[model samples]
Target: MITYSTVKSTLIEKGTRILKVLQFGAKTADECAPFGDDSNPIANMTAIYAETSTVDEQVIIGYINTKQLAAPGEKRLYSLKNDKSISFYVWLRNNGILELGGDDHNLVRFEPLNQGIAAANGEINTELQKIQTAIIGLGGAYTAGHISTDIDAAKINEIKCL
Candidate 1:
């Protein structure tokens, strides 16, 4: 059996050029890595890897399963700011969640339709109105009354950096 690490090692040689962006057969992909079939070693394998040598930033994204892929399950990227300390995993048998340990915090699951989050958003609108009023109070002279209220991107003619 070709181990996942072994496959990656074979494809990417040490002291070779680092990949800038890579995306697997996509359900989703990021701006850094666009989705494509990059001549997968295995007939139906799907995987991607991207790296920026300047800041040593790297991202790994994948989607492989029984029908679409031969090796392992898909993986979302997890990258840190440090170089020579990055790690990648490709051995998830079934669909699962990826967890990270940081600041002694516990795992958090999110629901897009959660009611609590919805309720909080209601209050956010009223608070935003107050912020708009405050910015207008600054007495800046412009055709637009206030930046917060006049948020039409096309109407924005001039911008000044302070």
Candidate 2:
């Protein structure tokens, strides 16, 4: 098996650059000696020794378990972050649960539903209000105002740094 190491901080493109191997001993030159001299290896390793495979001050660690599960049940998970900041963090459970955001207060759990997440808008909220009103009109002892207001576009917007 060929082990890949990064001698310095590297940048990985989203759609390009194939990174199928695990990188170990990042920023540690001694670990790269066994891999032999590299004319030009992954992450531009031209030096005789190895360096860290940090992408934008974030280290990418990958794990592979071939014998853990069947081919169809295989799963891959990744978490990228640094001491100062977090690049990306997510978890996928074996029961098909996806959790995002690292902390409990900020974390958002997405449970499986018949129809995935719906877009935030006024129409759905309006319909929901009507249903609540109808339920109350039928002498149902249920509290109302769960979805009091509709979410408008101005209240939320997509923001991407890069």
Quick one: best lDDT, which candidate?
Answer: 2
The residue pairs found clashing in candidate 1 are: none
Could you give candidate 1's per-residue lDDT for residues 1-162 as a string of tens digits? 111211131234353322322233222212122445332233223345444454434444433432322236554333322232324322333555333422245432233224445556656766666666666688743232222222233232353221
TM-score of each: 0.19, 0.28
lDDT of 2 by residue, 48-113 (tens): 332255433332232222223223543433333333233444555467645454435542233321
TM-score of the candidate numbered 2? 0.28
Model 2 segments more than 4 A misplaced: 1-6, 11-79, 84-87, 103-148, 154-162
Of candidate 2, the 10-residue stretch with the lowest lDDT total is 107-116
Q: What's the TM for model 1? A: 0.19
lDDT, residue 141, candidate 2? 62
